[model samples]
Target chain A: MRLRLRPRDDSYYEMFTDSANNLVIAARLLVELMSDGADREAITEKMRACEHAGDDATHAIMRRLNKGSAPPINREDIYQLASNLDDVMDSMEAAVDLIGLYGLERLPKGIIDQIEVLERAAELTAEAMPRLRHLDDLTRYWIEINQLENQADRIYRKLLARLFSGEYDALTVLKLKDVIEELENAADAFEHVANTVETIVVKNG
Target chain B: MRLRLRPRDDSYYEMFTDSANNLVIAARLLVELMSDGADREAITEKMRACEHAGDDATHAIMRRLNKGSAPPINREDIYQLASNLDDVMDSMEAAVDLIGLYGLERLPKGIIDQIEVLERAAELTAEAMPRLRHLDDLTRYWIEINQLENQADRIYRKLLARLFSGEYDALTVLKLKDVIEELENAADAFEHVANTVETIVVKNG
Candidate 1:
């Protein structure tokens, strides 16, 4: 196949990469939130910045798509991809915000596993966005994301049961659950991004 | 403008109406759950059946879409509408299920206000679906839904503040929070459905 260069369409790939890389940063900040003696205020501020950056990146994609020049791929896939990435950031940022809002400290130790899974998933997603160009050798990306999501689901349910296990007071459990739910939502959002990529690949391959 | 005699396309309207009507029923079931001696187990089971019926209606639309005839509205609009309605059902059902799972009996009185908002939103959504054919009078539907959503947001925040008001024990607070969160999600999903309808009307009209 000849390499037909589409210069204008190339930036969509770059914007997606930029957007996903923002998630990597936010996920790391989420991990930081789990750290003892972590400056949560500062980390939350940084996470807010990352989320705004993500919003800007998503808007850039939308602005480009709305300019009416045909994209390199299906328009719906681009919209879905951008929206899913934004959703992940929103959930991550929400998790950080709730920690501040509820003045919660000393979270359950089990949630570190949840935050780490998000970090790994973000890493995997960031690695996969650039692969959209070739649309080949991409099977592993979505497959791994699916596996990660299943792992996330298990971790979330276990945490839920533990929250009800009478270890903590009701108020503490309430606050912790809010933060955990947001992390779970972010993990679910990551899988949505992968699904969009899979749809693009299966259609174009 | 004269209507095209697209007889086969008319059922799409029916399916959407059916789907929206199912929300109406589910929302009403949500209301019943709050009543005295409401048979919590029975209502959850009924809510489950309602959710399954909602899923079938959604699948029927998808099946017809996959049959490859062009839909009366944009294909994306059909998908967005169905998916949004399904999301509302999922949240409603999840709310009821959590009530059973947590064995929660006395909810915050404020939540009754929240449930009523969702009930009204569901009713408005069901009424608006049949109007998609002409796409008229829907300006009121979306606007009212937006207002309802704002109202729902207020009700949700008030409830949140109350939960943390140091009234209930921590464990009870945690359990009630889960059920409240799902109801809040249902209201948000109703707004999503209205947004989809607005998109269809604005684009086509």
Candidate 2:
């Protein structure tokens, strides 16, 4: 008797594909919000909007989990991955909200640079995501995503060190620390994506 | 054709399970450390040990992702969950580390109350975790775990409101906030567990 593998559902696969797309788009929006440098209120609104969209997508995935059969992989795993992606967006939005809410407009360049690193990480995550469905040739994307995540970690450490060592006023130090943490969180979310992608590739391949 | 759904051999699932257990144990230890009112250095060392254990578990899961088989979820979703779980631990550990590292000898009653909530949430999480392994009758565990998480959130809200109500000195306020956030973080970690368990139940049940 031959054991037949469960056929991968195209629609469920598509949901993940869309989730990856949303994350990439959210990352791009974050970068835009930074570069646009609009008024505080405007930036906050934009960030909030991005967060809302990301949340919708994440919730959609969760709702999907409840509404459909499990994907070829573990349902809990997918839910976790989706929630983490949403967290990245949530943290980004919160940073912007806190800045606007607390009137912290002047941020250090180093923190902004870390945000850039996060953007890059998000892009790498986006690139790695599609490969998960294929599970056949997963080496390149998985390795690159991990490399990007590690780079993000190194940047976080460097940023933290600079944050502590550099001379700044107490209030400035505090605000910058929060900003740096948010950026680090964004990177962490991306690293989660990389981690998940690698896991899928390894298990399925 | 009979479709056989074989369990994936990836080690991330096991690593995550171990991490879940470690987190619960850590919370219990933290409660002991706080209640014992040990010397600053002693409490710090114990907290560090818990943090180290959590870090090791995270590293193991990530390492498995990078080198072993792919995880059993959507790449994007897995990435998000793993990263968020790590963040929860990082934040919680930082809160405790700061306490000992900064020579905080006494925890306020309010903070202690919050820590109790966190400990309770962790306990609920540990209880819910084993259900994930067994696909049957898991929804009940998820529901109870989520209720515990919500209870923790309420404790956080009430505590934070009290903190900001002009009842404490500035330094005291800052430290209290840090501790509160950390306790809230442990609660957040359990929320993640609930989300994961719910998804698993959806899939298997």
Candidate 3:
């Protein structure tokens, strides 16, 4: 009888990539929501679905981790990466949901800048997730995510200054700041995901 | 010749307890800051120092983790617990700093409620940290912290409803919400720390 070891399952990487893709989808939807005359309800509903899908992907990864002998990378790294990606999705969903809950009809100028940073960060994250398998070419991914987070931080501070400058009514300033802060958090979450991946690479290398 | 294995260093548990004690001190200071006729500058300055001490404790734990062969628990669990404890301190410090930066003379009513829950949670956390060595009597600690977080979430939602009810002007609502959200995040961080402990207990049991 021929004996064969089970092939090392690599599906965790695929699931991580899927979650990253969901973040990209959510980020794009957010950008579209800020556009003129966009269908807010439909776009946000789709974003919600994307966030749900990300959660499902994370669950799948966890289930696999529980059953599998060991993952290619450290198990905790996988868990942290999954959780941080889920956080990015959660922050994006919260920002969109608050927009709807607060009945915000107009987009603030600073929001567009914030969304642009989120979109780029999400794109970079999606691009980086697959590299976990080989741990190659990841330095630029994390570095650029860090730079994007710094940019988002600057935009966030400037947005707050503008909000409090009395250019807009108090209510308007409050609502816009809520949304902007979530976007900033989403950017931070992206940086956190990148940091986790960097840690995994360093440990595994 | 006699062979002896290096004794397992258990100082990480002590450092964790120290960090949790720092959280309790910060939380108490936060409660004091919300009191009438409180010295905002001095109280927040002291809170800043508490946060710095928590950072130092966390750094010590990390330094030990890096050099030590192994911990009683999983290395990643140790890292997660320490990091989450540090995050609780960070959120509290951020809330206090923002309160100072906004230069608000008076706090909203809900802040006191939030601070009380934080104080209780911090106390519970301090009580729980030492149990990390034995993994005994941890279930009640985490369960109570989870309940406290739920209580905090209820208060937070009610607080938001009040903020938007037009009792206060838009700017005050803006400032208060920023502080309130950080408090909520602190509560969430506490829950996260508890959850990490629960995971460790389950794994080690």
Candidate 4:
């Protein structure tokens, strides 16, 4: 068997780690934004900053991937991973921004459950990024992310049922659904990142 | 410059074309579903089948990309293109399914504008996929798609403002927003697919 040489610059991995770290911050901010008596404007501004940071990190990775001859992992895997990570940040930012834009004073019931799932998923993703080099223990990261996504899904559906139950005004339901769906999208994006990592691992291993 | 050998199986391009064609049918169905006195169940069922066909096409392209030694385009581009195309289908399917699930009889105003944009975008995508091999005349395809997506975005924002204007009941706003947002997503997905194609063209040209 021919031996494959490792990539010269490991900066892509570092960039990924940076992006994943930003996601954790964004997810946490999302949780904070949902809490009572929170400053919606301040939290959303912070989340927007986090998203911008995530975008820069993703751009850095893409720049290196393009300038360099070969990536440490498959080039496509790097792109997909970076894009998905950015997507998670974007979704979080959108949710937070929607809450602020709608001027929602109160969050609907079941949102806390979704936020919990998001926080755990974000934390697990940050933990998994560093292990991309070896990828041996990364299976559990993705498996767990998949489970968290399912948990988020259940909570999302429950929240939807509540929204349509006539408890909230139509305008309120509209605002809350936008926020909840974005959170669900973030959860799904996290799963996409995990799945990308798994694909990279299988190819490399 | 070294000459690169083209891929042996061109089925991937054909598969993309098939998927894009399905989007056209779905878009047409969406327009049909929005018309008065329409059979919502039958139309949504048809769109769901189109989505499944799109999925199958995407899977076929991916299977070939994985199994084959090389693709006609960059492997990552191929994967992104396939995945984004599938995403457009998913978003369209979600919008249609929501209408059925919500049992919404009357759609909010400005929906028809969104559908028109989607229909044009879908047609343009169907026109663009086959040109992946030549990488010629694709710039306009992506550019037009971007414009169409912007159009869809404008319509979406207008619809949102209308939804929150107290014109509809709270439950009605909830249901209509879901449907409109999915259409907006489909428009975004089409732009993504177009952008991927443009990137592939730049790389391979």
Top DockQ: which candidate number? Answer: 2
Q: What is the TM-score of chain B in candidate 2?
A: 0.78
Query: Candidate 1 chain A: worst 10 consecutive residues by lDDT?
Result: A1-10
Off by over 4 Å in 4: A1-10, A66-68, A143-147, A150-166, A169-171, B1-131, B134-158, B170-175, B195-205
- Tens-digit lDDT track for model 1 on A1-205? 1111222345788888888888888888888888878998889888887877888888888989999988889998999999999999999999999989999877888889999999999999989988898886777887799789869976886788788888877677778888999999999999889867866765565
lDDT of 3 by residue, B1-205 (tens): 1111121245778878888888888898899998888988988888877877887788878888899767878888889998999999999999999998998787778889999999999999999888888877887897799789879976886788678777888778878888999999999999899878866764555
Model 2, runs deviating above 4 Å: A1-10, A67-70, B1-174
Over the full model, what C-alpha lDDT does candidate 3 score relative to the true structure?
Answer: 0.84
Question: Model 3, A1-205: lDDT tens per residue?
Answer: 1111121246777788888988888898988998888999998788877866876787677667656556788776787898899889989998988787677787668889999999999999989888888998999999999999999999999989988887778687777777888999999999999999989988987
Which residue pairs clash within candidate 4? A170-B170
> Evaluated on chain B only, what are the TM-scores of all the candidate structures, in order?
0.94, 0.78, 0.94, 0.93
Instruction: Kindly list the per-residue Cα lDDT of model 2 for residues A86-173, writing each as its tens digit.
Output: 7777677656655654455566556556667766666666565566666645566556666766776787778777767757654455
Candidate 1 lDDT, tens digit per residue, B84-156?
Answer: 9988998998788777666676888898999999999999998998889888799999999999999999999
Ranking by DockQ: 2, 4, 3, 1
Docking class of 3: incorrect
lDDT at residue B127 of model 1 (Cα atoms) = 94
Give the per-residue lDDT of model 2 (tens digit) for B46-86: 66676677777666666666764666654444454456556
Taking the tens digit of each residue's C-alpha lDDT, what string does model 4 give over B1-205? 1111122255677778888888888899889987888988888778777877777777778779778767766787788888999999999999999988988877875899999999999999988878886876886886688689768866886778777777887777767878898999999999889868856754565
User: Whose DockQ is higher: candidate 1's or candidate 4's?
Assistant: 4
Q: Could you estimate the TM-score for every candidate?
A: 0.67, 0.60, 0.67, 0.67
Q: DockQ each candidate and list the results.
A: 0.15, 0.21, 0.16, 0.19
Docking class of 2: incorrect
Residue A93 in candidate 3, Cα distance off native in Å: 2.1
lDDT of 4 at B125: 90
